[model samples]
Target chain A: MRNRKMAALTTVPYVIWMALFVVIPLVLIVVYAFTSKAGGFTLQNFSAMGDYAKVFARSLWLALAATVICLIIGYPVAYALSKMGPSFQRTAIMLLMLPMWINFLLRTYAWMSLLENTGLINTFFDNIGLFDLINKIALSLASDPSAYQPIDHFQMINTQGAVILGMVYNYLPFMIMPIYSVIVKIDRSMIEAAQDLGADSVTVFRKVIFPLSLPGVLSGITMVFVPSVSTFILSKLLGGGMNMLLGDLIELQFMGGAYNPYVGSAISLVMMIIVMICMTVMNRFGDGEDQAVML
Target chain B: MSEKLINLENIHKDYGGKVVLDNINLYVRDKEFVTLLGPSGCGKTTTLRIIGGFETPSAGVVYFDGKKINDLPPHKRPVNTVFQRYALFTHMNVYDNIAFGLRIAKVSENVIKDRVTNMLKLINLPDYAKREVSSLSGGEQQRIAIARALVNHPRVLLLDEPLGALDLKLRKEMQRELKSIQQQVGITFVYVTHDQEEALTMSDTIVVMNKGKIQQIGTPVDIYNEPKNAFVADFIGESNILDGVMHKDRLVSFCGKNFDCLDSGFEKDETVDVVVRPEDFEIVPIEDAQLVGTVKSTIFMGVHNEIMVETEDFTWKVHSIYNAEVGDKIGLFLTPDDIHIMHKS
Candidate 1:
């Protein structure tokens, strides 16, 4: 009885913290989502969500693209890192995590200057006559020669690709760390067994290494997709406010020209539901063993 | 006798200048159950891995069916391995795990299904095709691991301490089962183990190794009865090795007494090592004994009592069914055949 009492007492602080900061805020959001400005229950907030459907579509597709790119780039890196010697692995992993030590906004802001029209990348391209060569090809391809205009610089910033680049840059470590740790923990004997049973390198990867790394991939997707979908600052800075995402729209309802907490809460609630559904679907694909490593 | 299916010539392995195998030369005949027996870090596993193509020897050549296969990868080699830890794919079911190699080889699904079903039956887990790999017991998993490798139809099957993880009773049962499986499969088995009893029980030929060098290779009975040196004599079983000198042909002198032995070919009055197994000493009356001592300690070891007797120059270990109390005088008698002589190393 005393042990049970002590355990309960130890949990009291966490319980109080959860109730105060998490549970109460969620309850307030749900309440606000279903109420009007005058405090009467109404569905008007949800009914107005159709106007932001394009924003929702843009956010989902962009986040999905960013996540796929991260997987394509991160899986090979993690696999390679897992095969390195212990000291080299430590140094490589530290380098992968070094960028994350800086503030997230600071990192995204660094990408903005590098991707501008007169940024370092475009300046180097111009110095090499890359824009002039592209213009020459464009002039030859066009039917009317006068319609082709020579460009001085490439417009890399203020686009959806730039926002994705920012998101991928900021969230890449999240994807690689989990996958690297998981691959490193895999038993060396398992790969040897696969090879001894007449599996080549590709087949061993397809049948053993890749399937065993699914939990890490799922967690990486969750880690990268969640923030990329709801991130507002990336769209605002790199996209120059043109690619307004769901997060930006939600931000606008309460803090922008439209000061309506009701609609903001409703959008937040809907995004939460969608993210929860995506997570539930993903967990079905992962075997329950390595799922705890996500947190 | 069958043809040699695998051969290792002048095999040497080292890890960054630290030698693991030293000038090793061994061969295995077709359908022979050969075992590499040694303690841990004795290069037995390294030799096995070299045969399986997992590790290339630092300086040597490996031949499979009279062909030099030193550069061949493991997948291309006609060999399979049952790892120490089973190494089952957790994401796969039993059926898929067994059919992994077949699918990799692009075998048809119908044939894969048939082979997997047959393998499951052979391993005595006929209804376990759909069960998850994580849900099986250790011995069941070990059997599945064997079945998984055997389904590939390799000419040589390598086992690296496959029964090292089981309990005592289960290990004994698996040993018999493994021997039966080797006979049933009729393929060359290169098994590695450290347990002397396991080596004796399952292997047709046992290769004893120590310190990256081959100590002795022979049949189990020969290894036990005629160990080449004091190391093999002590490693195979309990031994009372005494430093002595050979008096003449078939005669040895130890404990200030001359005893008749079956070994010869030693120079007159040359120093030698004499090995006598604990079980070979017969307890008799003090007057009828060749040597006598007081019992220092006694241990009941399941079927027999092991007693330590302290004599004038050496303490002898004797295994007998009769009980001997500590501090009591006892007598030990040895026949000519029980005395083994070896040149001093």
Candidate 2:
């Protein structure tokens, strides 16, 4: 009885913290999502999302691309990390996470400098003679005589590719950490058992390791997808306001020149519903139900 | 046996610097249930792994079916292993787990199903095909593990302490069932364990090991009765080892009493270690006995009374039907066959 009382007492601070930070803010968002400025219930805010459908479509597509790219780059890195010695694994993980210690906005701003029209990448390409090849290709593809002007540098900045690069760079560590943890926790005996039963290295991986790591892969997908789908800073700075995402549209309603909190709340609510649906679909596709509940 | 099915030639294994197996040579005949019995970290599992091709020996070669196969990976070898913890794939159900090897072999779907059904029946889990591996009991999991390995019909099956996780009753039941399964399948089995009783109960031949070396390799009776060293005598069963002197052939003296033993050829007054099993000692009267001692402790085992008898120089364990109280005098007699003599180390 005394232990129960002590436990209940210890939970008081956490309960208060959750109510103040999580519950109240969520209630306020819901109230604003469904109510007008005169404190009257209305569905106009929800109908407002139809106007920004292109932004939502573009954001989802870009986020999907970023997620796929992260999985492609992160799976091998996580597998290699799991195979390293303990001290080496620790150092590798620390290095992977070192960039996140700085301000996220500052890091996103740093990409703007590197991906600009006259940026470091174009300068490096110019040194490697890739700029000359690109110029010759453009000249050959031109139709008119005057249109055969040589290209000076590639227009890589403010493109969808630039926004995706930012998202992959910022969210890749999220992908690697979970997959690495799951791979490391896989029992060594399972691999040996597979081999002992006449499974070669490739068969063992296809039959044992890959299937076992799906839970981590699912979690990594969600981790990278959710944030990339809802990000505003990367699309604004790296995309240079040319490619407005759902987050950018929502930010415009509440904090930008639009200044409408009701529409912002409605978009936030819709994004939450979309993310929840995506997660459910992913969990159904993979055998991540056991781990999905945990997350 | 016509020829050794598996022969390990001068197998030496070293981990970083410390040697786990040193100059080990062993041979397993076809259809033999051989056990590698030793304490933990005594290289028994290492020997099993080397045969399974999980670990490469630092030196020497392994032969399977009279051909050198030292460099063959485990997947290419004609052997399967039932790991210590069962190592069942958690994501797979029992049916898929059993069918994994058949699928890898590219067996037809119909044949895979038939073999899996037979294996499930063989392990006595007909209705557990669709159940997840994690839901099964320890004994059920162990049976599935055995079934998974046996389904491949490998030439040899290696089991590394497969029953170490079970309760006593389940372990005994599994032991009998595993022995019968091995006999039924006619596959050579190389089992590693530290349990002496388990080794004696199931193995056709027992290889007693200690500190990276084989102490003795013999049948259960020979290992128990005619141990080659004190280590084997102490490890195999309860023994009352004592210091004695060999006067000449058929004559030995210990506890200030001369005893008649089986034929022995040694220098005069050569020191030897004598092993006498506790159950071998007869509770004779003091007048007709060769040696006598005072009882120190008595324990009531289920079938016999375990009494410790202390002489002036050594303490002896005597297991007899007759109970002797503490501090009581008891006389013990030994026959010539009961005395096993070895050079003192």
Model 2 vs. true fold: TM: 0.97
Residue-wise C-alpha lDDT for candidate 1, range B17-64, written one tens digit per residue:
999999999989999999999989999999999888899999988888
Q: Which parts of model 2 have CA positions greater than 4 angstroms off?
A: A127-129, A136-145, A285-295
Interface RMSD of 2: 0.5
Model 2 chain A worst lDDT window (10 residues): A286-295
Model 2: residue A267 alpha-carbon error in angstroms: 0.7
Best by DockQ: 2
Let me know the TM-score candidate 1 reaches against the reference structure: 0.97
Q: Cα lDDT of all candidates, in order?
A: 0.92, 0.91
Give me the displacement of residue A205 in model 2, in angstroms: 0.8
For candidate 2, lDDT tens digit of each residue in A206-269? 9999889888898899999999999998998999899999899888998899999999999999
Poorest lDDT segment (10 consecutive residues) of candidate 1 chain A: A286-295
